[model samples]
Target: MLVTLREILEQAEQGNFAVGSFNSPTLESVRAVTEAAEELQSPIILSHAEVHNDIIPIEIIGPIFIQFAKQASVPVVVHLDHGSNLNIIKKAIDIGFTSVMIDASHMEYEDNIRIVQEVVDYAHKHNVSVEAELGMMTSSGIGGEETQGGEHHATQEAEDYYTDPLIAKDFVQKTEIDALAASFGTVHGIYVQEPNLDIKRLKAIYENIGRPVVMHGGSGLEIEDYVNVIQSGVRKINYYSYAAKAGAQAVKEYIQQNQNLFYHDYTVVAKQAIKEDVKRAMKIFMNNGY
Candidate 1:
């Protein structure tokens, strides 16, 4: 069933498990995640960023994701991830997204609050949940195009953009967001090496902010790191790179093994491969049952 983000995150917080928020760029990716959730009896969130929409187009994938959410046996929340513009956020809300994120963390604190407040007001009116980001995440070392109309930045400098605990508290209280994505020590995209997560800082934010916190850039973390972070107060974990890698690797292996296989036949192999990967992630997330 399609459910609100507040309900999902609250359940995750109370149960001491982080909900897996998977990013899907295609129908196969969406199928893998929803099927995994149903098979495992775990609640999950299907997330897509506006940046991705630039490639796949929201009008094409939005309805498909919503349909999958409604058909899932377990509660599933269709969410907009890292939404940089109010226009896109509004479109998600209008299209029946259960949750929308207003990521204005790159802006000044006051401006961030103002933008989030606008989203919260609009989302709440439609009985949807809103998530706001406190810090910015960027690719490490490599300079990538800014997806949300911001300057190019590096993940190594993310510590400078880390969310202030006090400012986070004030931002949440002022904007009335249902959840806040706090940047402890994670960045968007794959890490060049093992990333050192700031667990102590995350604990402080969880203890001080008094709301469910989200951790993005979950693809490269060690299992122990993920467990420790979730225990500390990361109620929602967003993943993208791992799934993409799994899908691509599966198709490559299939082609290499079967030299005569047609390109059209590869979709089935890719789907099964990604499905298994999603299930593995769901198990690691430990969100099964309750």
Candidate 2:
């Protein structure tokens, strides 16, 4: 059933687990995410990033997302991830997204608060949930292109972009967002080195904000890290890079073994591979494996 982000996060908080939010830019991705969620009996946030407009327009993808969410057996939240501006966010809202994220983290503190507050006001009136980012989650470019989405693949220092607990408290109160995406040590895309997450900072932010905390660049963390973050107060995790890479790897292996491969042939392999990858991730996010 289609549900709001707030509803899913509330359940996560009560259950002491985190819900996985996966970026679904294609039909195969939509199928894989919803299918995995249904099979695992896990609530999922099926997201589409504004940065993916070049790959596929929101006008084209939005209804597809809603359709899948409506048909899924498990609760599904259709979310706009890293929405760059009001125009894109408004479009998603009009297209029936249950949740929208206003990403103005690159702006000054006041500006971020102003933009996000504006969105929260508009979205709340429509009964949609809002998520806003405070800190700058840096990306890693050590390997190939870090991610196809807006996150990950930067050479900047992660510590420099970590969120302050006090400021996080202020931002939440100012914006009135349903959730806050705070940065600590995690980056977007594949990791070049092992991530040393600041569980202390995360706990502080959670305690101070008194709302659900979102962790972006959530693709490559260790199982222990997942458990710690969920315990600390993470209710939502945005994960994509690793699952996308897993699908790509599967297609590569299929091509190596077969000749005369058609588009459907390898896309099927990729969809199943992505489904399995997402299932594993959802299990970890449930916070019961450790």
Candidate 3:
């Protein structure tokens, strides 16, 4: 069953469980995630980031994602994660994406709003859901051509780096985004240190925003943290880097252990590794199917 973010998340808000948004780095990863979701009978999201287009172009992968979402037994949302290009956003919608994130988190506040509002207006007209981020989300210094060579801007003031509840209210009202990806203390990629979530801040945003709260940078958080944030009212969570790493490492280990295995055989092992990891994530998130 193909479903929108709003369709899946309204149930999450009522049931108090977070839906895992796993990024599809390859068509294989999407296949793995879909299998896991069907086996668990859980509603799942498959995402492809704008930054990863160099590795897996959205146009090449969007149709496959749409096909998987439509054919899946459990609910699925085909989402474009961290969309920076409006043209790509429009293309993904035309390619049949159920949801998109018009990420202008790096832009100035009003500029971010302007960019997101334009996307929302266009996406809404086509009946597609939109997600927009507020505040600055930091990186744990991993992934991509752009960031691989640069130093990560560490959080000097936690509040300065994270979303403000007041601005969240206004951002939602102005952008009309279906979901808000709120940055608390979590950063993208792997955790460089002990990850501590600002549960109070998450609670404050939930109390004020009156919209589905999304937790990105969810790869390294402790299981308890997922429980805390979902309870604090986060309906959707993004998990990617961990799955990417798991599949790669699994293939590497498999090939090394079985030196005679064919090159194509690695993909077979990789999909299973990705599938099991995705299933574990879905279980950890505890989706009680609505």
* Candidate achieving the largest TM-score: 2
- For each predicted model, how many residue pairs clash, with residues at least 3 apart or on different chains? 0, 3, 0
List candidate 1 segments past 4 Å from native: 141-152, 155-157, 287-290
lDDT of the candidates, in the order given: 0.82, 0.88, 0.85
The residue-level lDDT of candidate 2 at 78 comes to 96
Cα lDDT of model 1 by residue, 48-127, tens digit: 87888756878788898899999889999999988887898999988999999888887887888888888899999999
Worst 10 residues of 2 by lDDT: 143-152
Model 2 alpha-carbon miss at residue 150, Å: 8.9
Best-fitting candidate, scored by lDDT = 2
* Candidate 3 clash pair list: none
Clashing pairs in 1: none
lDDT of 1: 0.82
Residue 188, model 3: Cα distance from true site in angstroms: 0.9
Candidate 3 segments whose C-alpha is farther than 4 A from its true place? 143-152, 287-290
